[model samples]
Target: MHDTGDAETTVILDNGGHNIKLGVVGAEGPRLIPNSIVKAKHEKKRVFVGHEQADCSEKFSLFYVRPIERGYVVNWDTQEQIWEKSFSKFDIEPTTSRIAYTDNNYLIPALPDVSNEIFFDKFGFQEVHKASASGFVADHAYKIRRERCACVVDSGFSWTTIACFVDGVLIQESVIRIDVGGKALTNKLKDWISYRQLNVSEETHVINECKEDVCFVAMDFEKSMIEAKKRFDENMIEKRYIMPDFQTSFRGQVKGIREPLASDAPSIVLGVERFAIPEILFNPSDIDIDQCGVAEAVVESITQSPEDLRAALSENIIVIGGSSCFPGYRDRLLQDVRSMLPAEFDVKVSENVANPETHAWQCAEKLLEYPAQVAWINRKEWDERGDSLEYSRFFRTTVTSDELKATTQEFEQKGEKSPKNGEEEEF
Candidate 1:
């Protein structure tokens, strides 16, 4: 994929089990070129990935290949193909620059508990940044200036990650993880529908469709279920949504047909009752997890930090990741957190100003704002060091006070000026 005269860029990739998001960090923002690859069986093999693969699937038998499963990359060969093809689309060169230098760093979330050897060796990233650390770094970028503590509830395709951020940095020890995520939810919903409606085998593509179309988090479990169970009424059903036509080369209308149709497309209810379904984050057991929801996790993490810090934490609750965008998510998360917190605690979720799917990338971009970011490894430095432990120094700064303070000192002494402090540093 290397070609001379193309712009050199920094790549940020998040390898989720459901999808892979990659883009170059730039002035406009992180340019996300989705690597939502998937497994497919075709009569003849012709490589297509990301947008192209999506496009080709319309007229060809090419199957989408999702190479990651349950937060781990299952097929390195396929992943490599996806990355090479996807990055090539942007005209980004592979030749090493100072920015792409051994020190120039490529940041990606190494989904916790997964071996990153292949990612480090294959993707040409000197370092495989931990996803948890990246999440915290992202939280810090938009960290509200606040005295309260807040919890981060990251609900995504493979896992629902819960972590507590005091001020803006993550409390590493307090971080928690749940096996459930959008995938599990989708499967559960698919099982429900298959048992009740369709008897088709669960395919990733079709199940993903069902998830996007029919599945949603329930805020008031019993109440929402009661409402959903009531006899179908057009008033009770949400507006119908039609899947866009992929049959043609052009973008054309795909009308949403209503059910019991002589003409309309089959539709399902979403947001059946206002603020009802999205509340499941606080009450996981309702989904049979036998686990505490995100709100409770925040409280527990905060209490573990210090009972006195609870009020402070609640004031800065930052919700990012894909799941946070579920309608009524913010209101319900805030409400539930408030209920668990002391009467004096103040809870607020960040307002939606951009694509929630890209929040992590946004957070990664915000790292440029830090006044002291020595841990912010550049491509050249990464090459020189070639040491995981050295990188760990930067990683620890994200959550450890001692490391953060040391990093601050290093930045100050290196003559790297800070933007916040009006220095010449170009972090």
Candidate 2:
């Protein structure tokens, strides 16, 4: 690792599809901001950015225009607007300050170009460093667990990906991704709710909140389904979700299993959908997504690594991102991975559910200590080399645009709306 020695302000951003995590390298933690520009139907002609109207408790249809789609930046104009709104808080001197960005591996061969044009040409930033959403997880693990080899299972908004690293360097060949994540689960929950209860097709924002407040992963799929069928007081898996009136509350609440509610209050009786929703991560085929489940992908990723590092990677599987925050996610994933691996291989899965989505931001903040290793592109360097990326310093993966395109098509075909980055991070 090489240090630049110059103390330029490096803004660390863990840009996810649902939220953007922003902070300075030395700050205690990242500040999370909603990543979309929302246009509420009631507030006609007025647009809100960075959650300006997010807390406006009212009944309205939210039409969002996000810059990112399927873990990549597709509409740079909208992205620029969001970034402009977010950048106001940082007191940054673009000519001198630096940017540390992470996204879906930046393997598209064109992301760096677009990013440079924006940060350098438009935003006037002096330097920019980019990495994958999972680029720094290996290094972060090594720092805490002293584990030089790790397999990172990042289950975020756009999708879940499994990547293996040996000695903190990515094994490009050992990368596998499945199109199952928070957004998928949220939409699934919304569909189930609409089918069994009320229609919430336009209430995406509320439905998402409904999911966060009530959903959980099932440790045993069969047992949980059986438990979900039990009567209210007798059911251990059942819960009452009280929907916000928008007049008093902005988000829904998950009450006790037998909690009483006002007769007029809007509520949903959550049952098998809670566990069944998250189960898609373990069996994407359940949603008709033609990809292996998260655990299967993890095993596939590790088995593709060098034979010697497989054991080390197995013992250091670190799971992060938004979807991984679900209750019972770690235990279920650990059990599934252990069951699929060879009998002699010992499997260990680690999770920090408190704030799993911030792990990438934390790791990116640590990468600031080694500017040379990260390959910061200053203005002068950008002028000389144009917008081309140095693939050698950048992380590369076998996951392709075709795979991503297929994933996008599958979701859209199923009537699932696209969400911004993760637990996919960004610029």
For every model shown, what is its TM-score relative to the native structure?
A: 0.71, 0.87
Off by over 4 Å in 1: 1-8, 34-36, 39-47, 58-65, 73-75, 96-150, 213-219, 232-235, 238-282, 369-388, 397-427
Clashing pairs in 2: 17-420, 17-421
lDDT of 1 by residue, 1-427 (tens): 1121222445455554545555555656544444555334542555556656455554322345665555455666766676677657766444431121111111223433223333344444433334343344334433522222346666776666666654355556666666566666656654554565444243445545544544455556666667655654633434343433344322322223244433343333344422233344566675677888777776776665544444545655666666666666677677777787777665666553366566665555554233234233334444566556444654432344453354345544764322122222112
Could you say which candidate leads in lDDT? 2
Relative to the true structure, how large is the alpha-carbon lDDT of every model? 0.49, 0.73
**Whole-model lDDT, model 2:** 0.73
Cα error, candidate 2, residue 179 (Å): 1.4
Worst 10 residues of 1 by lDDT: 97-106
- The residue-by-residue lDDT of candidate 2 on 191-291, one tens digit each, is 88889998877888888877777788888999888887887468877777888877767678888766667557778888888889889999999989989
Q: Report the error of model 1 at residue 147, Å.
A: 7.6
